[model samples]
Target: MANERWNLNTTSDLTAEPGTPVGLVNQPRTAAQRLTDRPSDYGEQIVPPKPLWYLDKAGEPHSLGVNEPHQFLLFWRSNVGDKAADLDDSYYMGVTGLQGVGVAGHRVTINATGEVLQPGGESSATISGFWDKSDPDDPMWTPIEPETEYTVTVAAHNQSGEFGPDSDELTITTPAVGYDTQQLTLPPRPPNDVDFAAPLPVITTSGGGGIQLRWTTVPNVTKYEIFDNPTPGTTDGMDSSRPGLNSRDVKLGEVNQPSAGTPTVTFTTPAYTTPRRRFALKVRAVRTNSYGTAYSEFSTPLRGALPASTVAPGTPGAPTLTVSPVVGGQVKLTISPPTINASNGAPEYYAVYDGTRQVAVVSSPLGAAPHVTLQYAAAQGYSFTVAAGNSVGVSNPSSALTGTVPTPAAPGAPTAVAVTNVTTTGLAVNWTAPASANPPVTSYKVYDGSTVKATVAAPATTTNLTGYSPQTAYSIQVAAVNGTGEGSKSSPAVTGTTPAT
Candidate 1:
């Protein structure tokens, strides 16, 4: 092929008036501009088309785009002013450099190709490629001022390395991500629209299980940042770090929620000893997934509303449930009008009190009157209280209301107790054939000295020595008893175990 240089005129007409934070205008061309080649009088008219532009990631060009991501602009024009065949589907893109623009050095950029995008090219060629800041003068280093308009022109090269001539140039503005527009600069806007809400859904469950959150949707949000702060001992349910505190300062935990529309957040809390726990949670729109994390403003704090347990009622409605003289046993209890009465049941909570301190509390459903119980054993002075469980927590114990569980008659001393030593099975056959054993000796209440060792039935005499595998010495006894009749315990127990033989 003979060496030849086809002279081609190239230009465009896109303009960025002024004070506009200039950036890539990535719009496609119009059909009219692609259909007919128009002629102009001021010489700022339509001209011949240009070649396509592609990203070449080799040892040629490299630059970060809008989001500072590793991507470049791509442009292509016709070799002949005529509509070019489907050349778009013919090529792809890469990284590094293409044409003559690339990373000149670390911070500086370089672009030297006799091309400075001017406003004269038609509205068709989409410019896409390297964008560098450092410019070096190997060939011709021309510094492109940020926010300045420049022209990019493309030319067609034949397969055998021949020029099809110059194509029309497209105009574009270059602006670093931060350069602002006049005075109304773009405030830190989330990458795209973010979905969120003030006072969003918040909740806490039994035992500080976890805090849950949910919100609205956003178009281009990648992830969500959730925050929580403890409003310890707070009576008013408000989600916030007491005023003037940094979110982190008031932070309980930060959670990452999905940006898939539904605004949901959650953070688990540690175990709780107190009857009730409370907290405040807030949400912020964020996106760490993209090159530059796009973040939306924080939503107002939303105090999670937990189901507050209500206070137990006074004066039993149902049959009086005798609290087994045992500690930690609860009983079915409820307030007067089971329904919450804003007036009387307004803030009260159900608690089993032992004169001074409260032993148990129903701390949720703040108004529901449900069964409540005394967690501790009956002390000399003990009574129940449908105490208020509110901002100030369960109110001072309810009442030492004249209540008493008649002390159980000293259980009649057990009777007819008996015992035997078995050498063959290495077992203690202790039993009581008391006449009261008709009720089926529930268990032969046995004791080693004053300490109760074992409680077995008399009918079932042979007490297996499994617990004491080796020939360990043992003392055992038995007693005959029924729900109503407890008999005298067996006399001093006989010793036996896994035989020495």
Candidate 2:
């Protein structure tokens, strides 16, 4: 019970019999008033450790060890409580008064007893905690200065998030410059290292219909900052007044580097759009410690290379297609640009597909809708779909439009016509059916010297011409007919003559 101290149970308990020793228990306090008579005290007071020289430079005397602004003498408690095993595992050391250090306070993990190297090859017993400033919301231990007297303090933290009272204050004095043996001075350097170059970020498609950015990992980098230039090639500098680097550059987001994994950041929301979409992307490495944060210069866009979009445009909407019958057994496919949402930007082109097979890729022409004319067999069924595509990738195909070219317009003219049987009054005209008839040759018309002599139904290539003048020669021609109407007459009319009756 050596670590346990007497604490006020409550303000009302002060009224108890002076020597009663009643209502007093050594149980650890869980409330704000449990540590001492002060209502503000919550946890038990922790024992303070002796301050030791914080020597970062070799051959430096202990009296002049605080050479760097970020260096501080080591202060730690061997064990948080009497039980070294239990307290060290269950409690943490909360250090305050590390002026010029990170965010004014820090919660450092307890380190096993170690040694700090001293001058003349001598070593001092030291069990210190590592400084942590990665989380902006958490306590930050900033830089410490040399030749200054610092009032440092420490408190114990329980597993339940309760803090013990501050330990006895310790005033540690840093040696003044030009001490006995010329005190060591820290090398001149900027608080943060900004000379390193950042890796260029690459934008790629995400499996979840979003976009992902990746970059090479940098050593000692805790996180990566991503910036996008909406207008590529602009020389605008980052403006602090705005959200991103400048009026043109916007910070996409920051990704914490995992201990072991590819450096990547994925944005699932705020999908990309055109005209306002990110044209190029850059990345910078960030490192933080007790000294502060150091950032590498943002990677510049590669020369003569298109910058990756902050977010690849989302898959575009399916394109609408219209099919019309063109002359000569061809079908004209007119495509209406898909209704691209703001997130999809503008499509660069369209892909036309027949069933699952791709048939054509139609680039968007200036001031005109995309169209393609394809030869189609008359009356043959057709199924067509179109998909919109952009710089990133293609979209899902639109709904299928099913249709076929109109049946062949009127069959071709009869191939051959001749007067086979010549009679005094009438003669029989025979001809071959027209080839390339879509609906098949349905009927034919016989012409005698530019006059319609007779009409015959299809399957009967021959027709009899009656009422012709006897002993007169006649010019005979034949024409094919279909659902659309009659076709051209056979070329070069055949002549026939009848013997005198």
Assess each prediction's global lDDT (C-alpha) against the native. Answer: 0.40, 0.52
Error at 116, model 1, angstroms: 11
TM-score of each: 0.32, 0.24
Off by over 4 Å in 2: 1-323, 326-329, 376-380, 405-501
Tens digits of lDDT, candidate 2, 411-449: 888876777778798888888887677656778888887
Q: RMSD (Cα, Å) of candidate 1?
A: 18.8
